[model samples]
Target: MTLVAFRYWLAGMSLALATLVTPLSTAQAISPLGGPRFAAVLMDADTNEILYAEQATAIRHPASITKVMTLYIVFDALDAGRLRLDDRVVMTPRAVSQRPSKLGIGVGQSLSVEEAISVVAVKSANDVAVALAEKVGGSEENFARLMTAKARQLGMRQTVFANASGLPDPAHFTSAQDIAILSAAMIRHHPDRYRCFSEQSYSYGRLRLANHNKLLGVVPGLDGIKTGFTNDSGFTLTASAIRGGRRLIAVVLGSPSGWQRDRDITTLLNTGFTALDIRRNGGIEDMPALLSSAGFTLNRSLRPVPQLATLDVEEGDGE
Candidate 1:
């Protein structure tokens, strides 16, 4: 079924099952890990409701999660007919000079846009990110400007992009809520291309680059998205999952470790799904109360959602 039709059908099913949903016990609720650097936000993809949030609006480094926005620009180019998957993306010296966690393609070598996207999405290839940036925006610096512009256009007021690969720059930062917005926009505007994020691995020549996102096959209904890390950002992840025919986007940033980041995201998604079910069934009045019952510490001062302007873990200097 078409996505829209499926969403409509899912809404109906949710409402029908609402009356049958039992009270949520403590056993059913998952509490996320807490940390000084931790920030997160969970959103219902269909309704854009903020289901759970903790330090969600605080500024934090994005790490390799920057690639999500990079990919978004590429997807936009594809939609505008300026880019094609089969088109060649040459590896420039600058792209090759990028840090590790790269595809290792030679400076002069080339790969199709499709392959480039896979390596960036699945492998978190820094080199390929720069190549794609240069391809689309002439240089990484210029591309970053475009990234920031797109962020503003999409109502992401707190984000700023300093590079295409999300390498550490004092200027490159975003909040968890902003990341959730970006994730939803990608799924909303480019469902087809977004599937690339779900790929577990990508074959480029003899190398089989595995996705850095460890939760892919392990978490039920969890699908495409991204993972990132750096000394400054800690371990971060933006995950999307569909349960009970509803999709939710969860973003966790600045965890102390990769495993913890994954764990927090899993808990957030689970808690979010349960809360959504309860809300649909008329068992809850407000999200704060539900989150409290689920054992989450809420930062009661949430910033108001702005009107629309439009729209991983790892080591080294890259991930």
Candidate 2:
């Protein structure tokens, strides 16, 4: 089948996998952080169970984790038959004008929806993000509206969206726990489309980009998800992995380093499975996925940027 047709079929089949739905609740979920700077969570992707939390309910800047919502809307559009992946996403001056780590797409240029998705997935291109937003919601503002609406529907109590690219916006904020919910929805409600998050690298012309999440490459069974950072948000990662039948979405917001981010993710994952295995078989044992190819670790950790260790939070750290 053609790629666009395949995309449609895949998105459609993904909706069938939405068996892991959760109902709205007023109670704030748990977080993993022991202090204000860190917020973490371990969620069972299939059952919608929050296995662990630390300051999870505290509203904080999500950084590029906002892309989680962006991708959700993209997949929703595809599933709704509103657009095709083959559709030309014509970049506007506004889209190309955004900022860096982009595909460096220029205004008046055009890329297929599939190509645009790749650009955003691999490069976290703000340009492609705006392009996708414009196409999906007619304008970045409209898309932001749609994203916040979806957030509300998903029972995200304290999250809001001001744009699609997750650019630094004073009004755009989300708690780590809310991000975990969004992450769970991405994996549980749209497994097929979420695979795009696992892409290690993609190139547009001379510029090559890599997935920001380090765990996907280094950690076995980590299939896909998104990562984000900014002066305001610090290092944030929403990562997921499946070992045996148990799946977990781990969120670490406001981390101080890429090493710490990966370290926190692995620890949470190890903790979740360790807890699950013990609960199921009465004692912890080797994970089924580990037995398949243990030591199969790859360099998921991208080269550490110096600023990563000293990344600053937004002006509104507490608010």
Candidate 3:
């Protein structure tokens, strides 16, 4: 090659190397751990640094993941003295219309706020979500406005909600990053209610249900948040775990099957938790490329980053 051509190539190579070596905070440097083909994100529940992501902001219907927002507003009401666990909530016809993954609540049936929460958190109950939404905002439509307003306040720019039940509204959408941010908020803003995520099962009346969040019993210190599924959105999960004093939140959306979604989430948790100081094995022997190196490390802080970048990119542009 000519001297000029060689020098130009060398300069370009050097520039690329420098870019790779530039210092970055934990949130900015780490890429998504596994290359799943849909929206995903993992962040420090404490530091709010994104540890991993793939299409984190790709907006899609959240299915029951909508309940996370429902729980958020419910938590707010509890905080403001508008509601309480022991307070009774009467089911309305509108709440009964929500689709399945429900408590099968009858019209006029009443449950304490705490009882309703258990049914929704563990069972992913559509009926219960509507009831909570109504109790807080006087109607599901009004509560939805509250949910959207809260989303904007939390910087979930890619998210919009139409109902608390999270039924298949193409109009109701959110990103994995937004859900992670919401999950972290629920944990910090309402510890008492967030603990409900860790419970494996609950029974009300004649019905009993296991928590849809598969990681609850199997994953160490994984509790808080929810799971979701639908024909269009595939299978989805939002998971959180704390290990060695560091808390991490992970969200996976649009997996092809419920079992596969559970498996993918399990892999991420295994890597981010056990591999904190070394290499994250992700508990699988053959998928080394899917797992992260064991050496990633960061400090544990009680505070999450409060000011987030405006998540303006929508479904098409996000990731």
Candidate lDDT (C-alpha), each? 0.77, 0.71, 0.69
Task: Report the C-alpha displacement of residue 30, candidate 1, in angstroms.
Answer: 27
Name the better of 1 and 2 by lDDT: 1
The digit string of per-residue lDDT tens for model 2 on 1-319 reads 9854554454334322221233122122212322225667778888878776666776667767787799799989999899899999989998988766466667888999888887787678787888899998778877777777677778787777778888777667777778988988877788788888888887766767777776767887888787877655667888888999778888887666667777877877876777787778776544433422333122222223234354333321110
Shift of residue 299 alpha carbon in model 2, Å:
29
Clashing pairs in 2: 30-53, 31-53, 31-54, 31-55, 31-56, 32-53, 32-54, 232-314
Q: Candidate 1 has what TM-score?
A: 0.81
Report the error of model 1 at residue 181, Å. Answer: 0.5
Tell me the TM-score of each prediction against the true structure. Answer: 0.81, 0.78, 0.75
lDDT of 3 by residue, 110-169 (tens): 999989888888888888888888888777876777777677678786777778877765
In model 1, state the lDDT of residue 286. Answer: 64
Name the lDDT value of residue 304 in candidate 3.
31
10 residues in a row with least lDDT, candidate 1? 304-313
Minimum summed lDDT over a 10-residue window in model 3 is located at 299-308
Model 3 residue 288 lDDT score: 34
The clash numbers for all candidates, in the given order, read 5, 8, 5
Question: Residues 219-252, candidate 1, lDDT per residue (tens digit)?
Answer: 8899879988766666789999998999999898
Worst lDDT 10-window in candidate 2: 22-31
